[model samples]
Target: KLVVAVQGTRKQHVDTVGPKVDRQKKSPVCSYNEWDPLDEVIVGRPDNACVPSLTPEVKAISSPQQWEFFRKFGGQFFPQEHLKKAVSQIEEMCNVLRHEGVTVRRPDIVDWSKAYETPDFKSKGMYAAMPRDILIVIGEEIIEAPMAWRSRFFEYRAYRSLMKEYFQAGAKWTTAPKPLMSDELYDQNYPVESVEHRYKLSSEGRYVTTEFEPCFDAADFMRCGKDIFAQQSQVTNLFGIEWMARHLGPDYKIHLLQFKDPNAMHIDGTFNVVGPGLVIVNPARPCLQSEMFKKAGWKLVEAPKPMVPDDHPLWMTSKWLSMNVLMLDEQRVMVCKHETPTIKMFESLGIKAIPVDIRFANSIGGGFHCWTTDVRRRGVLESYF
Candidate 1:
């Protein structure tokens, strides 16, 4: 029961908050690891996708050269032609997933161009192009991350319809404590002067986000059955890691992995766990805790160099997204049609590669794995590490 005050006799006491969870039905949300046979997914939309303003948080992860794009087009839609190509590419990618016998669901198309003001801050919005950054599934639960970016604060609005349906179907839905993204949440002087300075700061575990409160993007974590690997990135802090560790309880082991990445935003592009005891690591962002994986008899393969050409506008992320392929099962993968070396690498490992072109989609941000958040994967919770 909820308590409400009757207002002026015009509005009666209304309880509009409670959502019922049927305990009898099995949850639609279920996934323990990345390699399980995918059953359902949530693909984000590029519609009304707006450029985030060049705030301090945005400044931390992006290169100085790319700052012009954000400055000129921030809080505005991306170039019309670019967004059109991206839409078509993603539609084809979704069809490919359906052909592979997986159910693909999409978030509601939101007008991210709308500007909003919070008590602590005022900002426009970013696109709902990357679902992997906001949603993560562990077993039967879906965790909504308390992300750091002020523009992305209301990003979860796009997924509420699906979240509600999943909840009614008995999935455990959890939204982390949203942080007050005031000036206190950022280190205004956090170094981004040059690549060398970034490298030094990252090595020392210094990031732009302060420990003022818990904040993280779901993409900062990589799920591998009982072992979940996470990184403290520019958008993810130590406080956020601690919050996840405590919230996940004893069923999961959150291993804080370190990498030598200057602009480490998401772990999937850097250290992706493809299968049981098999991980594809980015040679550019070497994992400092890789010796542990080696000691555990895990085969860590180096990803081939990305083939995304120079002058290709990658507004939000790095070219390492070529390595961010999604696993359909232990035997099949969704990869870039153009990345021949990546396809060859998978074929050599006996994993069949299903090629799809999303180069234009990659321009906005994200590849296969980054584009979709797996809702259900046929698997049970078991220890792997």
Candidate 2:
């Protein structure tokens, strides 16, 4: 009787272990810092890019000279010839990444000319050519930013498929609460006509985006293991930073940094954390907390003058995009082909510079770092600051 009972129990235990279940579950989204050995990445697409309307928020980031372009082409497609060259350039970038043995993923080609009406405002869509501006991966969670610009509100749609795929493969997916984007969200009278006034406003901790709601671009945050640095820019507000701090919980520390930038929109272009304790800082926009970095024993390298000519049309960014580079690992960096000084600087630091010509793509906005978001890097979370 005892032998028969024991056999029956063993058989029941074996039956409970279903055949469809696997014991090992691996997550597809994992990255802790910028300089780890990259496993996978999401590269943005420049197809059907649109110029945002010359709203107060847009006016805050771009210079007075570029406002004419926005006013003329707002809610309209970018020049097809320029976009064609950009498309071709980005394709080569993907090819280079793939050749380097990194898995390259592209967002869906989206139509940025479509007009949509939200309850608070009506606007056209913007292209998904800057994934770093919309998505950030912390630990295992990939959070989508509630973009401040109305034209970029629907940019997440282009990356929804990739997000779903990662979720199915055991990755944490979270999207921040979208703002109403009502008139109250913006400070219409925010001064942007003069650089001196904007500088004064920036020094006074004021921006075009009000504290009425939480709004941010993912590019505002620079990750370095447990210590993540963020800046309050025209697109990032205090409310948004607080929300991120709370959302991240106690596992991570959010450090608020202030720069002397009058038109700061993304941290990557201004203060890029390239490695564990190395940073490439923009001399044009000095960080007020630079002493903190110096005390922490972090090496801060000032980027050289950009080689982009005066005639090069940078509609949405400064020539400082030359410093905005992507690190394949701690030993390898992807820089602009024409930026000889930057290439020499990287080589001096014992890093290989993989040069590629994306001047046309730069006209749209962003460099290698802004063009791609690292999805999975082979590294664990470790304190670097």
Candidate 3:
């Protein structure tokens, strides 16, 4: 048996909806530090074109064709100039971090032409999202999670190769079958099922099985780590939580938020989390159940609705990419351009926000969090002496 130390809430984050076979009303017990009310965003440095704040610590493989793919599929909305601005912003972030003491690591962009050479990388699409679990760095090694999609063969060999290069040891993947009926719920556009798939990946890969047909939807994405744990209790759900508790211990905390809902297209399409204690969520998408937000101690800043008419070309174009932001550190954030409200909010709070143009990357449905896995992150300080 794997002897991993895990902490945080045992309850699934989805439980706020209602109690069912998979979800329960169990009082969450957290050994980790409670989220503090985040009020101010402290800008550490000046906004210098030369000085760096947001940095590209890591990046996925890229190709010219990949860039075209983004333009055709995800970047359809923005003019060339807008797109350029986004790309430049990401570079600025990377420079800023390097300007500071932090080290920025970029993955050699993936070469899709010779993909088969890497046995572990199955062609999910031109943009293969970085697994969330594996990206989080723990000590010297990076933890990885991989999943399977219909007709897509599991690329165990490619995984092995990738892990060996970037990480100290090989990776451990998390995945499950496509549990939802349709990829979308109620004809909504954003990627709700994709978020649900994350839970499945974590549970099945960890050997948890509820045997209950899992459900998926857009709102499910925003469910925090605690909410997801609270809803899970069946063989698979419980097993998943227990494994994480044992393995992760008390250092890491999981949080999830949604940018769209039943009629929505993308959560990050217009919203994102740019830093700790701040989120750039679009009010048009619909508000999440307040309990989840309150418990996590996140402060929300509503973004303006999409400027493009609901049916315009730019309408909901960000769906192809995951629009939400990822926290590389306390000071820097990576965000999608459409999530401008979030970017501005972070800036107001003094947190530096770097907007990455993900039109090319979003076609397969991933944002900064889904695209890059943080192999190592600073551990939260232990509360007790």
Best candidate (score: lDDT): 1
Off by over 4 Å in 1: 1-22
Candidate number of the best TM-score: 1
> How high a TM-score does candidate 3 get?
0.46
Clash count for each candidate, listed in order shown: 0, 0, 72
Ordered from best to worst lDDT, the candidate numbers read: 1, 2, 3
**Between prediction 1 and prediction 2, which has the larger lDDT?**
1
- Residue runs of model 3 more than 4 Å from their true location after superposition: 1-126, 129-141, 146-148, 151-162, 165-260, 263-276, 282-288, 295-297, 306-323, 336-340, 355-364, 381-385
**Which pairs of residues collide in candidate 2?**
none
lDDT by residue (1-385, candidate 3, tens digit) is 3233322345444423322222232111111111221121111111111111111100011222234444353312234454354355445545654564435444333322222222322222122223431222333333332221211122223344445443222223333333332222111221223435433443333212232343211112222223221222111133333444445556544333332233232233344544444565556554445456657687767654432223322212234233355565557666666666557766777767766555433333345554443433444333221
C-alpha TM-scores of all predictions? 0.95, 0.94, 0.46
lDDT of 2 by residue, 153-233 (tens): 889999999998887677889999998899998999998879999999989989999999999999999999999999999
lDDT: worst 10-residue window of model 1: 4-13
Ranking by TM-score: 1, 2, 3
Tens digits of lDDT, candidate 1, 1-385: 5555442354344556443455676789999999999999998899989999999899998989999999999999999899999999999999999999999999999999999999999999988889999999998999999999999999999999999889877888999999999999999998788899999999988999999999999999999888999999999999999999999999889999999999989999999999999999999888999999999999999999999898899998899989999999999999999999999999999999999999999988898999999999998988889
